[model samples]
Target: MTMTVRDLRPGVRADFEGFARVRHLALPFYLVTPDSLVYDLAHAHPASHFRPLVAEEDGEIVGTAQVGIVHDSPEPGQGYVNVYVHPERTGRGAGTALVRAAEEHLAGVGATKLFAWVLDEPGNRAFAERHGYRGSRSAHFLRLDLTNGTLPPRPPLPAGVELRTGADFADDPRPVFELDSETMSDEPSDIDYEFTDYEAWLEGTWHHPLFSPELTSIAVADGRPVAFSAARTDGGTRYGTVMTGTARAFRGRGLAKLAKADSLQRAREAGLTEAFTGNDARNGPMIAVNKWFGYEICATEVRYVRELG
Candidate 1:
């Protein structure tokens, strides 16, 4: 059978479902839903030229690629094309085909630098190396059993600090956006990002179907958000912390830990049984915080870079 690469029809339920299925099979630690998939496709920035591609064999999706330029970055000509093939469907050229198509699109749009994440395994690393991708930073995915595991008791908030939920920002989320941008600016990564586009953030993140505002915890200081833990739920037992960080001024105060612990406790109270999150391997502080919360390293992935100019 021959495998072919083509653009994904996000409006097509089968296409979104197939992409989510492959992604879930390959990366089961994270939460993904059809609604989230559709929302991402529909609300992505027009300037980024976002394109989702899928590899098919005999009418079955075997791989997927999310190709787009990093429009929000200060640098130009930067692009990303994350490729994930069904674990059971490897060695069939689906991955290679998807990468080739993604590269062509990114290059056509003037992307001189391309990056992808490859699972840190022999075969996966070999595939990326064969395609001229060089290994870079790595990250770890952590999981916790909210139902049976013991979590730290909710710590008392320091004076002048209060814990709040995302729902509290229903009338005006701009403050939360500012806090997120401030914390995200210091996040370790190869790519530098700026969250100046509030409308885009509203569509791409705040209103995302997977986002559980009720479970998201924010630490407030003098009526301002200092740290937060963004929560995402799959409408089931699985809950994920998409981002947990503190502002630069609040780093040494342990506000991030407070926000994350509060969020996880809220997740358990909301009946979520499983919790998942990922942290860069180099982020020792965050990793330690997660460990303190009884989360264990479940899997790891490596970032790979390739130039297509």
Candidate 2:
């Protein structure tokens, strides 16, 4: 069957399920659902120009791509295109068609440099190179079998330090936002971002469909949030930590570790069986922490970049 690519329709149940299914099939560790997909499409910043595209083959979605401009990056012309095709449908034209459509959308929206994440497999690397992208930095996805593996005992909080869940900040999340902004600026990434808009952050992160406030843990000191382990859940057995960071003033004190350990125990007791997280290959401290919690490297993906005229 011939493949055709089109922007995913928001209200259509088929498109919603198809897009999420394709993502789960290609990258099982990713936390996504039909609700989250539609919420992201509706709440993304206008400047981002985000589009979720799908490649359909005989009425079935065989490929998916998330194309967007880096609206928060300090650099204006940077953009990203992440394409994933159904594992069973590889070698077909689905991937190629999805990439072409994504690239065109990004280029037309004033992008000069485009970035993509290609799996570490030989075929995936060759495919990116065939489309003008060159390899850059890489990241690792780690997984823990919560039900079968043993997790370290919850870390004891230091004197004058208290551990709390994200639900504790329901009335006012400004302090948490401040901590998130500071830590985000220090994260390792090719593009530099300025997270100055609180409203935008609330829309994009705090209110997202899958954000599991009860599962997230925060470390409080001096009456404010000093570190946090942000989490998302599939509402059933799967759990993922999106970010675990500590303020510069609180680093080296094991605050981030305490928050994560607390969060993990919460997930396990809540009946979650799988735990997943990603760390940049260059982030040694985080890798060490995850390893301490019994997470093993499950997959690696290389970032590919292309500069256009």
lDDT of 2 at 234: 83
**Model 1 agreement with the true structure over 16-60: per-residue lDDT tens digits:** 999999999998997987778888888888999999999999999
C-alpha lDDT values of all predictions? 0.92, 0.94
lDDT of 2 by residue, 3-58 (tens): 89999997998899999999999999789999999999989899999999999999
Q: 74 in model 1: Cα distance from truth in Å? A: 0.3
Q: List the residue pairs that clash in candidate 2.
A: none
Instruction: Give candidate 1 misplaced runs (Cα > 4 Å).
Output: none
The TM-score of predicted model 1 comes to: 0.98
Each prediction's TM-score against the native?
0.98, 0.99
State which candidate has the highest lDDT: 2
Q: Show where candidate 2 strays beyond 4 Å.
A: none
Model 1: weakest 10-residue lDDT segment is 30-39
Pairs with steric clashes in candidate 1:
none
